[model samples]
Target: MNGRSRARALGVLPGPLPTGPLNAITDVAGVLVGHTTIDDGADLHTGVTAIVPATVRALPAAVHTGNGYGKLVGSTQVDELGVLESPIVLTGTLSVFRAADAVLTYLMGLHPGELSFNPLVGETNDGFLSDIRRRPITERHVLDALEGAHGGLPAEGCVGAGTGTTALGYKAGIGTSSRRLDAGGGPVTVGALVQANFGGTLTVRGVPMPVEELVPGAGRVEPPGNSCVIVVATDAPLDARQLGRLARRAIFAMGRVGASYSHGSGDYAIAFSTADPAPALPDAVLSPVFAAVMDAVEEALLNSLFMATTTTGVEGHTSHAVPYDRL
Candidate 1:
């Protein structure tokens, strides 16, 4: 929206499904997204991104882990209970606990008498381009992201949790996309927001990007201990088990964009439904939703890379943006 182009604008369509109006995760009704970018123009370049549903009540949700080399706070509870009672917060690796604590603080303030709370907080390493050791994310940053959550197009690339992240040898940050599926019962929307920080070959629609040719001297040096966290939201009445299936599809979509799923990469996807309590969709009708999730996830990952601008951070380290002309 800020004069920045997305993958679609650059002619990189991932699949056949039609995208929602905004072509973003916010296209899912009542889902709000906010970001707190902590860029000091010097060392700090990390911040937080919050995904808040319409209300702070339990919603059907599930988490799937592709490679578990990083932290994902409050995941087990969601898996066990088959619901999420908190707004999902994402930030840098070292700042995960602080973000989770802040989410707890915010949720507690909303419901004073609630005795227990499970705050979903996830993270990916941003040490390559940011002073991650400083752990600059704070309670205020997390709260700001949550409080400012709004429905519409969300800012992507070098913002929020993805500020200092890199993927496929290029700068990447927050990216989102959505798909409207026409199923047997009715139409349902599936949206995905990705914090892409993993390393791979940089493929777009089955074509390997010429990273070496485009950016000479940029060898295949994958970042150490990288990761990606994807959040999928849908308006379909999907139970936790169904949501888990969607989440797995999201993780699988990563490979479509050339994700290596390396040993040190922690690839995780959290899927939730915003529909009111109703009969879950039949398993037979879930194939379209799965296809939608895959398409959205792949496009979102590319948006994270395409929309990102070259960033210079900690100790003069720079993560180059994907060359649009070459693409």
Candidate 2:
């Protein structure tokens, strides 16, 4: 009976725009999400999450860094080339190298005899909750996550790369939400997936949450400056530049959710589209896309808090989920 529900399901934080069928990032056609959780021991509370774009190959993309306080592997190339060469991976901070190498290895197996591939991997410091020094993640976990990726309702909170993450003094993890736009041409979908590990005031529907009162000893946990990795996907046929613009709106949404934009926070948004060769939308129509992203991101961040359950890790340090009664 420890099941947790989404925010909208309880009416605590309904987003502005109408959601796609699933209301999750997978609602974007062909986009897939998968995770490999590794919480084997008191100290090993970490894993990997993978997002595989529809193209099954390189796709036009962009990366926007709200704060450059992270070890984002293979980002410079994405910024320069404006194209994502591999499926994006998320994991712990210290394990970024392994995650990147694993992504590259998987791509190699798919396109054998192909060399020099760039892998995009994002991470946050799960060290506070898990024994990060052990580096529990492995290349196999990344491949498993990638191979298992699929489109549909995604499993969020306390899973995958979010397994050991804490946010706003709560046990925040993976959260995803999607918004659909009916802009005369056709219905376009924009989805956001987030690793919620940073710190903030924790707001829902414009009201600030009292994390300290909600959780026992919540005030003892550290404050902002950890990190958050937001992966956005759309079917709008946007190019690298437009995707970068769409990515930036995610930070605004983060602020809305109570992020302090602290120096230690590595806030990044990686956005791309499945419809390649489909031209980028005119700037005139891009405003709605930006709006959609902000709405979806805010809702997604709340979902992370609502869906996650209390978790106890190394040294008996427990990250309590926002108490259900408070909502």
Candidate 3:
């Protein structure tokens, strides 16, 4: 079960922009998010998350690599073809290959006789709190996540692929937020989902917080080679190039929340559009979409921390959630 309020509920991350009814990625019509969490007595902690876009079919998509230190299958195909042939899956770094294979199998089952399909899978290291050596995440977890995909708010923080993730020295996990923007053409919705495992100084708005002072043993125990995976979805019509630009803006949202962007961090973002309007929205109007990306990304990151509960795994190593009172 979720433990605390999201950042907006605490009045620390609200902006002028409004959120959709569920204030989640699902707010972008036809998008669904699901999770499969694995928690074995103190040693194995890892799982899979699946994001289904547009429900019934593939959609136009784009990807941006802020830091290329991790594995992300099918990114090249998505970039080359400007299409997303499969649902997006997120899991631990080492589980990416298996997860991709599982995703392909799952999709193939959905469309039997489909011989070839590019599986989009993203990952971040969760070894710090998980017995990653066990390779506990299996095809079953992938199938479960895909089968259980739902169109309401997703389970965030310490769930699914975020089960064992640690970020900004806190027990961070799955986080999501969405924004509603008016492009003069009509109202467009931009939503963000983040698997937070990267390290960084923690900040709120423009104020950098002394993380170690707030959470004991924060900076000392977090491992190196951390990573973060951001996924953005929108109802606005945008081609692959425009979507790539939107992906970059999602990274800017990381800076807003004080990401360290360290050498070993694998920071990547993927963006997709549910709409395919002719000519697309005018480039001049993309500013609202960009701003929406930044807003949703920042708030989602905060929610990853705010909603997370303390975790203890492998050898009694503990990753504590940020104390709610500090806010």
Best by TM-score: 1
As for lDDT, the candidate ahead, 2 or 3, is: 3
Candidate 3, residues 1-327: lDDT per residue as tens digits?
A: 665788878887557899988889999998999999999858988899999875535687899999999899999988898888889999998899999999988888889986788999999999988988788878999999998998998989989999999888788899999999898579999999999988787788787665678866665456666899999999998888889999999987898887889898999999999988456887888988898899999899999888989899988888888787875
Which portions of model 3 show Cα errors greater than 4 Å?
Answer: 216-219
Q: What is the lDDT of residue 46 in candidate 3?
A: 88
What is the C-alpha local distance difference test score of candidate 3? 0.87
- Clashes counted in candidate 2 amount to 1
Give each model's whole-structure lDDT: 0.91, 0.86, 0.87
Question: Which 10-residue window of candidate 1 scores lowest in summed lDDT?
Answer: 216-225
Indicate whether candidate 1 or candidate 3 has the larger TM-score: 1
Q: Give the TM-score of candidate 2.
A: 0.96
Candidate 2: tens digits of C-alpha lDDT, residues 1-327 = 248989888786455689999999999988899999998658888899999876656688889999999988989999999888889999998888989989988989888888688889999998878888888888999999999999888789988999889887788889999999864377799999999888777887778886887665666365333899999998887888889899999888898888877889899999888876366677788888898999999988888878888888888888888877785
Instruction: Name the TM-score of candidate 1.
Output: 0.98
- lDDT by residue (1-327, candidate 1, tens digit) is 435689989888888999999999999999999999998888888899999998758899999999999999999999899998999999999999989999999999999998999999999999988888898888999999999999989999989998989998888999999999876579999999999999888988998885777787766547777999999999998899999999999999999988889999999999999986378888998999999999999999999989898888888888888887788
TM-score of each: 0.98, 0.96, 0.97
- List the lowest-lDDT window of 10 residues for candidate 2: 216-225
Name the regions of candidate 2 deviating beyond 4 angstroms: 223-225
Which of candidates 1 and 3 reaches a greater lDDT? Answer: 1
